[model samples]
Target: MTQQTTLHAAFAGHVAAALDALKAAGTLPAGLSRAAVAVEPPRDPAHGDLATNAAMVLAKPAGLNPRALAEALVTELAKIPSVTAAEIAGPGFINLRLNAAAWLDELRTIAALGNDYGRSTVGAGTTVNVEYVSANPTGPMHMGHCRGAVVGDALASLLEAAGHKVIREYYVNDAGAQVDVLARSVHVRYREALGENVGDIPEGLYPGEYLIPVGQDLAREFGDKYAAAPDSEWLALFRNRAVAAMLVMIKADLALLGIHHDLFSSEAELQAAGKPDEAEAWLRAHDLVYDGHLEAPKGKTPEDWEPVELPLFRSTKFGDDQDRPIKKSDGSWTYFGADLAYHFQKAQSADALVDIWGADHAGTVKRIKAAVAAMTGAEGKPTPFEVKLVQMVQLMKGGQPFKMSKRAGNFVTLADVVEMVGKDVVRFTMLTRKPDAQMDFDFDKVVEASKDNPVFYVQYAHARIRSTLRKAAGEGMAPSADHLELLGEEELGLIKLAAQFPRLIEAAAAAREPHRVAFYLYDLAAALHGYWNLGNDRPEKRFIVAQDINLTGARLYLATQIGQLIRNGLALLGVEAVEEM
Candidate 1:
């Protein structure tokens, strides 16, 4: 078998070189733009090895019919060393078949690169700020926040693999009304800790009993110091303390899923630093904000709805249905007001900003985008601000909805799910579907070892590869490229699947969907398992061919490369690749 360089990159280079030759030979028009030329594997494997759309894309511009252009390009492309056969297929598409050595060379590249096989430089030098799992620090994280946390973390890893400088961030909503309720709830327990009968938790306050510990801690820290003080005197002090404590609990819950943010931006801190005031003044000067009366929002008209003149952001000018309020009737800054300031601050240092939010916040996406546009004067242009609305997740056990938690709160805590099925299983299961689609996380199914369980199927494949390698090593066998020709079509098929890893990473990173990596790993695992099953019926296909050490070494090398791919993919998803079941 002949040697080759990287598959996709090599083919792309050949296509460019072929186009340049066409221009040089005067057969095609000089100055023809090669931007539209694309080389990719054909959808159907039967259509040669790789396909190009150069003919179709440049035909009209070259003043030649597509078929004519294809014929001309085919003549030059067939001269390349790797192109054993070049043929024109449907509608001017040129399919090129490479020699068997090209596929074998790809396998060699995977083994040499190891874990860095799929790393790409598509996003090199770009700074991306991914803000995810910004669950209000009012209590422990619940099941609703699980998917966003996993997706955000996975996307951050994927971007890093694509050579982007990524910062994983969490926006703590400490200045909001929810934190006030949390403070009041903790204050009730604080009063009870001081030997006063605070009675049952009042309505409209945080009813979760998790605050009992925080209340007891506060009591111990300041023994009855402000137990009888008015809320005006203790609200700020208690709010600060409660927010700090709740953030610790939230961080612990995230750690249960192996998620840790590089930064935790606080709305309270931003406001305290005068960022919101500065943003407001900047918007007013730009005429993006003004005093205006707002129409009643569609569908739900509040009973107290009135045309009160408030400081309004002209979101409608940028595509929102109506202008949005920056301050409420009570003169306090609204949540959106603080969010705009935070996003603007983030945009100062980042080339791109991504926010992972729950689907319930879909309506706010457009206005937030509009606010970023107004702040940066990037209206009608591509702005770095993007909000990914993650649909909800339903936690299940067996065939029914699961709802037991140590906190006994309205939703199951993330820590509870992680404790039940392990961090790897929880993270992998959450990523099985796209963020926009709702999914059910079944506790029983996720832990199963059957093929129906994606996580188990993938982990089992990696473990089986590792086990085989260990047994091979026990017999003094190691991976070698000397006898790769012993591999047949079945083995080459597996290598082809592995070769898609780099392309997959680039596509998934550009699309900002890390779930694709999980799906690709599942497919690769299936290829490994299906090939292994063949050895059950035909012992000759077994990896450990005892009679010939050279053949055994080649098969072991193939198996090792597959394992490396699975491990690299699982690492991106923050899931551990197990060596054993």
Candidate 2:
């Protein structure tokens, strides 16, 4: 079903219809604005089940006071079959309470839709390119890359769930000074593999031991053939081999977290294809770039600073602090220039673009946004572009700082964390916090089978529900809606929480935040557990009441629906819901 037909959407439409009724009665102006009206769950459940700002949003335009408009709107809203009460609060806000039967119907919808209950058409199938975890192809991915990788993958999934055609992409930084260092490091290990005693790695080069295997492979194929050659003679050959091998390890690291990119765009390939040159010419034709000398950088000046003309993009016109240099004095493209070209090429196929970057690149957002605006301007239409800067994750074990990885030189590798805990834990924990906030991932806490561990807690709730269903099935007690009318407050409360999933998924996808799904799952699990504990004091509240088959069927239906909702939520986060934890 379309999002516009959901329960919440129906209420929003009711609000609009009420406004139109007021307009028909000439109680409100003909051109009253309803665009700002929002129908959503109130911040405090005690306020009401759902609240709307219809009166407050349109009062001034309608030439009526807020309370006056609210009073008029409530009359029409209360006429809705499911709306039992509509009350005007403190100034103008209208709070609504739907009958308990409304939530029961929502539970029926969940069972009918099953896994597709939360899917939405909010994105309208717009093509979006999500480029993330573009970690340099010089070594295995470290902990620093974990957050963005998970966030990007989850966001892509979320967008698709919201009906966006999303392309998961990884831009490989294969052409740069760093890859040269990787090649040199691999050459050192190659010499050692050829029976030459290579000393300690130099200070400026990569010192990771992960390259030892790559070196051994090279030696096995061509034993010391390039070991004694000049640096110029073997640099390109070694760089290509090293980059290819490192990418293999990188892809494997991503696999550990259940991530796979639909495309791996290479900077080297773009440069070789002269895309950067084309971007420079395009910007030049638009007068977006010009040969200019920049002033000394603020707060710090290099000792070798000198005035020299360079091809620069007028990023200052598009909200950047200063004009950005696109080409160096040597007529070579800068990193930003190559990145701009890549984005330009991406914009050709996708209607929107999103980049998941480390927080360190926060300073780079404006320049890239400026470049996107310039490139998309040529097409005579604005394309949506966003950069999500993911903060770092601090790893801990036993309450002490945990930081060391031979594969990544000095930092903890993503594979290391995934191996310590399973992929599901790693992914859910990464999404526990918003991407812009710094978080601590304690190894000990995530694996604990307690309420404090969100992933385990949510998984356990699903498992418990499944176990209850299995017990009922063994006794020939299948879920039946014959006694659905017997469900009470606790049952309806759980259903209300489950009903929010479709709305929550749409909002999270629009906001590009997957952590909302995590938070919602936590709340849903808590609601289920709360109702489950109620069975301790009130045995009649339990799912499998042997004495009353009808009640047992009803509670079992609720339990099965809750399990389905939890499973659907976990799927969005790329976490599996196990039948047994």
Tell me the tens digit of each residue's lDDT in model 2 across 1-581: 23225677667778888888888998987865566788889889998899998888888877789999899999999998898889999899999999987777777778888888889887899999999999999888888899999999999999999999999999999888889998999999888889988888878878888888888988999987889999998888889999999899999999988899999999999999999999999999999999898988676567767778989999998899999998777877889999999999999999899999999999999999999998898767768899999999888887877765556677678887888898999999999888999988999999989999999999999999999999999998999887898888888888888888888988898889999999999999998898899889989888888999998899999999899999999998999999997
Across 1-581, the per-residue lDDT of candidate 1 in tens digits comes to 22234577777788888888878888689888877687877899999888999999998998989998899889988988767999999889999998878888898888777788888787976999999999989889888899999999999999999989999999999998888898888899898888898777898988888889888988999899878889998898899999999899999989988899999999999999989899999999888899988887676577857678999999999899889999888888999998999999998888888999999999899999999988876454545778888999887789798768557467788888787789999899888998999898888899988999999999999999999999999999998889999888999899888887888898899889999999999999999999999989998899998998988899999999999999999999999999998
TM-score, per-candidate, Cα-based: 0.94, 0.94
**Cand. 2 Cα-lDDT:** 0.89
Which portions of model 2 miss their true places by more than 4 Å? Answer: 1-5, 16-36, 58-72, 299-304, 378-381, 404-408
Q: What local lDDT does model 2 show for residue 427? A: 96
Worst 10 residues of 2 by lDDT: 1-10
Query: How well does model 1 score by local distance difference test?
Result: 0.89
Clashes of 1: 0
TM-score of 2: 0.94
